[model samples]
Target: MEYMDMYKKWLEFDEDTRKELEGLDEKEIMERFYKELEFGTGGLRGIIGAGTNRMNVYTVRKATQGLANYIKKQGIENPSVAIAYDSRLYSDRFAKEAALILNANGIKTYMYKELRPTPMLSFAVRNLKSTAGIVITASHNPKQYNGYKVYWSDGGQVTEEHAEGILKEITSIDYSDIKTMEFDKAVDLGLFNYIDDEVEKDYVELVKGLTVNWDVVERVKDTLKVIYTPLHGTGNKPVRRVLEEIGYKNVYVVKEQENPDPNFSTVKYPNPEEHEVFTRAIEMAKELEADLIIGTDPDCDRVGVVVKNKEGEYVVLTGNQTGALLTHYILENLKATGKMPENGVVIKTIVTTEMARKIAESFDVEIMDVLTGFKYIGEKIKEFEEKKDRKFIFGFEESYGYLAGDFVRDKDGVIASMLICEMAGFYKLKGMSLYEGLMSLYEKYGYFVEDLKSVTLEGIEGSQRIKEIMEMLRMEPPRDIAGIKVKEVKDYLKGIGDLPKSNVVQIILEDESIITARPSGTEPKIKFYFAVKGKDNAEAKDKVKRIKDEFLKHVKL
Candidate 1:
């Protein structure tokens, strides 16, 4: 049917949706109805409005119906599912809609009673022995966006095989054939079960148990001055509970952003990767004379940190810096205490800093680099568990995602915050701070710096231009960047190492710097990631500017 006919059908919607539709002009209608919102491997994400291209009850119902069919195919004896939602607008409504559709199809759903983080949903899937899990969140996207993500029974985001199977079901099923049962009716029939309090307690305990150095935690539990902000999402309760329960008495919460607000009115963007999101926490840290500040994103899967530098001023550490620091901290403690596993392994994404490799080698541990995404890291954990050759210790991406244990297959900001606090406390006991510890690592590992630049080209033309840019680079590979020789190029689409095929390119320079270019899987943007090591910070900064400027001249973006 044409979007005009669909527009007329929307007339039967509630007053609010009807008003929105009535206000839209022709161009607005075209943009909203140009194409259906895609169901990518990770799942669906889009602006919340009234159209096939938007995220709404209709899209939720259609996607859930597809997922329900896929779940039935898994052939579990009981075949139940776990459902969770964040603090996004209509997230609760979407969760209920998914539950009702699953129940309508005779599959049971364990839905959270309130908003929860992404990692919790992953844990809930395995804890309940369910067929799969659904998370109604867009991670750290802006206020107008919401999303649907799926996790398999292994507690990881669905792998490629599962995603392909689900896509087949989604494409074959017509939107009209999607069915839904009323939420109340499903509950009364015992098809929808609200997750109990014990489940949350078990998850918190699981995180607490993953702490490496309890002695260090106890030594500075009271003196560890830390500030945390959830950025108006789902991290408020669990993050605080884990910290306070672990005996961090001096922990302070950014009171203004502690509660859930769909608008995220306090910050320009709710992403933890953006330094501006820590504005409120930085202020609170300064007033309280805190040693460290932590900020989690909307879903609490990514965390950002601010620590007092030697100059007695606070500085926001980039994700690479924090990952390297944490890597060193975790490994040093393991080796120092004789707890380091003989076959220990640490995993990082391709775009992450190479300082990880240096740290792992210093401990005589193996390092694995997967394509971008925590799911790949999770895949390695499952592989190691089966092979029984290596023990998983730490995993992280350059995008502020990190995982230490296999309890959750995705990044756990809750645990990452705890570990960072503990790491800081250990440094404090040694008469230093995390910032000073980071600088020490630089001194040991030579100065390593990274820079990422994203060129967002939205809509149809932007996408075409992105393709053209990638093709241009592939066809005419750069022989030199900023007078530095390009040693070789690795195209991941043809498969690299033991990794699966992907549309990513790595330009290895003679100086050992790495330049990676890949299109964003979910959004309409192309990102360029640069990594370089130098004798000091200034040389690294200069190298980045020269390489990036030369690279951009070839793209015409």
Candidate 2:
């Protein structure tokens, strides 16, 4: 349909939608209806508004109907779906909208009574033995964005095979065929049900059970001062509960950011990876002399940490630093307790720090590399479960997402927050803060530092420019980066090893530094990931700057 036609069609939906479209001019109408919001492997994400290109009730309904059709095609007995939502604007309404649509198709749905973390939705899919799951969240995106992410029975986001199938079903759907029933009517028919707290209890128990060093925690539990902030998202209750249940006595919550706020007024962006998100938490930490600070993003799937260095100044730890520390802690504790699996393995993305590989090697464990995205790690976990040859120990991406256990096949902030607090306490028992603990690791493993830089290019012209840049790099590859010889170039578009094909290119330098360039799957940006090893922090920082500057010089943009 043309933009004007689609605009007219949307106006026929209802009064509210018409009102939303009332003031839109031709340019605005074209922006809204030029194309349908894409349903990719990770599902739909867009600005919340009334349009075919935006996230709204109609889009949600159409997606749900397609999902229902797919479920019916599978022939699973009494197929059901598990639904969860974060604190984003209209998240709850979207969840309910999807549930009613599913119920109208005679497919049952179990939804949370209130907001919950994305990981809990993953767990609920497996715990309830449902066929699939949906989480209404935009994760760390800005306030104007919202999304719907689809998951399979294994609790991992749908990969290529499943996503293609779902996309096919969705494209075949029509507006008239998308069905929905009254929420009350659906509930009375036993097709709509609320997920109870017992399931939440089970999730918390599993996270608590993954504790590595209880003795260290017990010794410093009383004196381990810590502060946490949820950034006005869904992690407040679960993160606090796990810490208290594990006996952290001096834990404090940043009061202003404790509750859910859709606007996320405290920060410019709700992403935990951004240092600005920790402003309030850091203030509380300094006043209280807290040992550690933690912040989780809106959906509670990613966590960021802050700790005091030897100079008594608070500094943010990059995702690589945190992952390396966690890797060391989990491996060391396991070996000490004589529970280290003979086939244990740690998984990381191609863009993550290579320090995890060194830590795994030191402990006689294997390290596996996958494409970026926690779902690939989750996919590896499922593979491990089915193969029985490799035991999944831990997995993380360089984007502040980590998973220590297989109970939930997603980056779980609830579990990562609990483990981080415990790690802090464990080090405190030895008179060392997390910064000291990290330095200790650097002393053992070579000093490895990683940096991520993104260039945002918006709208239609920007998309073409990004594609051109990637093509230029692929066709006319750099001979060297920062005066060093380029050892090899791995183009992921041709399919790297057993991984699926993707539009990514990785350049390996003679000095073993790695530079990966890939367009962001969820955002309109191309990201450059650099990993370098140096004798110390100074050299690493210098090498990162030189390589980053030289690499950017090649791009015409």
Candidate 3:
């Protein structure tokens, strides 16, 4: 159908919705309707707009109906699902509509009474033994976006095979025939139940158990000055509650971003990975002379940290650096307390820095590299559960997502917040800053700097352009990058990489610098990850700048 025809369909909508659609430009309508919102391996995520191809009530209903149909086909006698949403616009309504649709199909639904983090929804899935879970969030996306992430019984995002099955079922549905009942009627009929505070309490208890050195926490609790920001999302209350419960006395929340705001009123982008997002928190930290500044994205899945470097200037650490610091801190503490597991494993994505692998090997802990998503780490937890041979220690990705324990299958910023504070306390006790500790790690394990660049390709044409770029790169793999001889190439989509098939490619240089390219599974963008190592911080900084400049030249983007 033409975009103008879709615009006419929008005109047929209710008066209020019609007015909203009419106000949008032709370019906006074309972008929204040029292609249908896909059910990829990461589930559904898209720009919020008025079209069957965008994330709206109609699309949400169709997705729910498809998931409902899939559940019925699986022959689960009493299918039930848990639904939760974050603080994004329309998230609550979307969650309720999804629940009502599922209830209309005779499926039981457990919905959160208020806004909740994505990890809580995962926990609720297993706690309730529901067949599936739905989280209405775009994770770290900007305010104009929203998403629906599906989770399986194990509280992990659906695997490729399962997602494909669900996609098939979704495609089989006709948008006009999906049934949706009134939210109040569904609640009255006993098909919808609101989750209570007991679940939150249980989740808090589980996080508190992940603490390794409560003695240190108690000793340095009052002395450690910590600053935290939730970036105007769901993390504020939970993160603050957890830190307080753990005895962190001087924790300060960024006041402007403490409350949930769908527009993310303070920051240009809600993502914690960006340094600009930390402007407010950094200012507050400077005022308080805090030891560490921490921030979590909207859904509270990824975390970012800023600490005073050796030069006494506050610097934001890359996700890989943060992960390395946390990994080293956790392992060293465990060893000091004689709590190191014999068969422990540190899980990370293939694109993550090799410095973490080196650090893990030093402790005699196994490092397992999986594909990009954190769900792969969750899958490993399930594997460890089935086979008691290996123990899961910690997991992280290059995009600021980290998990210390298996309490929740996905990344929990609440857990990361607590552990980061504890780590800061331990370093402060040693009279060193987290940044100094990071430099010390680099001094001992070689200085490593990692950078990620994403190229956004919007709409249908953009998708094809992304595909063309990937194909071109695969066909004409770079023989050398930035005067460095290309030593090896790992092609993941062909399953012939040095690792496995993962829709990623890694290029090793003669100087041992690394570069990897992969299209993002969750968004309409291709990512380039660069890593360079040097003997010291100064040399590493120089090498990183040169490599990053040359990398862009090579990619010609």
Candidate 4:
């Protein structure tokens, strides 16, 4: 159907809803109804509006109905699904609506009493032995955006096969025929059950088990001054509780952002990747003379960190840099304690820095590179568990998501926050700042600096433009980037790379620098990842600036 037809349907809503739809202009309606929300590797994410493509009650109902249909066809006896939501706008209502729809379909539902992180939802699905799960969250998207992510029985986001099946069911559903029961009626029917505290306790205990050396944590617990901020999302209570339980006494939470605010009142973007999100936290750290500052994105799936350099200036570390630091720290500590597993593997995305691979190699650990999604990492962890071939050590992506263990099959900012603080304490005990440790790591390894640029393509036309640009790049590949000769081109779409098939392209320069171009799955954008190695810190910094400048010149962004 045309967008105008969708717009007319939206206008036919009841009084209040019709008024709301009428308030929006033609552009708003067109943008909302232009295309259906896609189920990519990241699941469904979109702006909140009154259209089939938007994330509203009707869309949620349809998605839930389809999920229920898929579960029924699977022939699982007494199939149940777990549901959870974040602190975003209408997340609670959406969660309840999803549960009610599933319950009305004769499927059991286990939902959290309140908002929770995405990882907790993943854990709950496996703990409750449910056939599937739904988390009403957009991870770290801005305030205007929301999403719904589905998970399989193994507690990982639904993979391609499962997603395709769910999409088929979704396509077969008639929007008007999808049934939804009242929340109270669903509760009375005994099909709805609220998850209890025992699950939280179990999750906390599982996270505690990820620790390699509690003694190190206890040694400098009081001495290490650390600042943490959840960026006004679902991570506040759990992260703080974990830190306190693990014996970190000097942890300080940013007061301004301690509570959940759907608008994310303090920052323009709730994402931790942007340094501006850490402005207030950095100021607080400066006042307290703290050694480390940590920030987690809204859903608590991604974490960012800043540390004081030797020059007493705070430097926000890239996701790859932070991941390398944490990975090296964990593996080295394990090796020192004689606990390094011979058959251990580290997982990362193809766009992530190769420096992590180099670090893992020094410890004789294997590295597995996957497409740009944590679900792939989770899938690998599940594989390792089943095959008993290798232990999953650490998993991270270039977008500030990290996981230390298999406790939860997702990028967990709660655990990442705890581990990052503990690592800071480890360096504090050695009479060095985290930044100094980073420098030392660079000195031992080579100086590796990585950067990323995202180009947003809005509206329907923007997507077509993105496709045209990718085709142009593929057909007429750049021979050189910034006066540097292109040594190799790895096109993941054709599966011609060090890894499998994906819609990504990597260019290797003569200087050993690397550049990757890939489209974002959740949002309409194109991302460029650049990595350059230098002999020393000065050389690395200069090369990063030069490479970034040259990259912009070539891409003209």
| Candidate 4 lDDT tens digits, 126-156 | 9999899999998788899999999988999
Candidate 1 Cα errors over 4 Å, as ranges: 1-18
Tell me the tens digit of each residue's lDDT in model 3 across 1-557.
67788678767867866877877787887777666688976888887877867889888888989899888889988889999999898999999989999999999999988888898888999888899999999988989999999999899998887898888988887777798888788889899999878888999999998898888898899889988999888898888899888888899988999988999998888998898988888888889999999999999988999998877788888889889999999999999999999899999988888899989999999999988889889999988988998999999898898998776899889899889889988989899999888878988899888877889987778888888877776788778766778888777787853543677877888898988888887788999888899888788778877877887776677
**Which predicted model would earn the best TM-score?**
2
Evaluate residue 391 in candidate 2 and report its C-alpha lDDT on the 0 to 100 scale.
89
Q: Per-residue lDDT tens digits of candidate 1, residues 237-318? A: 9999999899999989998999999999999889988878888888888898899999999999999989988888888888
- lDDT values for all models: 0.90, 0.92, 0.87, 0.86
Pull out the clashing pairs in model 4. Answer: none
Query: Which residue ranges in model 3 land beyond 4 Å of their true spot?
Result: 1-7, 23-27, 496-500
Measured with C-alpha atoms, the lDDT of residue 192 in candidate 2 is 99
The order of the candidates by lDDT, greatest first, is: 2, 1, 3, 4
> Residue 308 of model 3: what lDDT?
89
Candidate 4 minimal-lDDT segment of 10 residues: 495-504
Clashes of each: 0, 0, 2, 0
Which tens-of-lDDT digit does each residue in 520-547 have in candidate 2?
8777789999999999989999999999
Clashing pairs in 2: none
Better of 1 and 2 by TM-score: 2
Indicate the worst ten consecutive residues by lDDT in candidate 3.
496-505
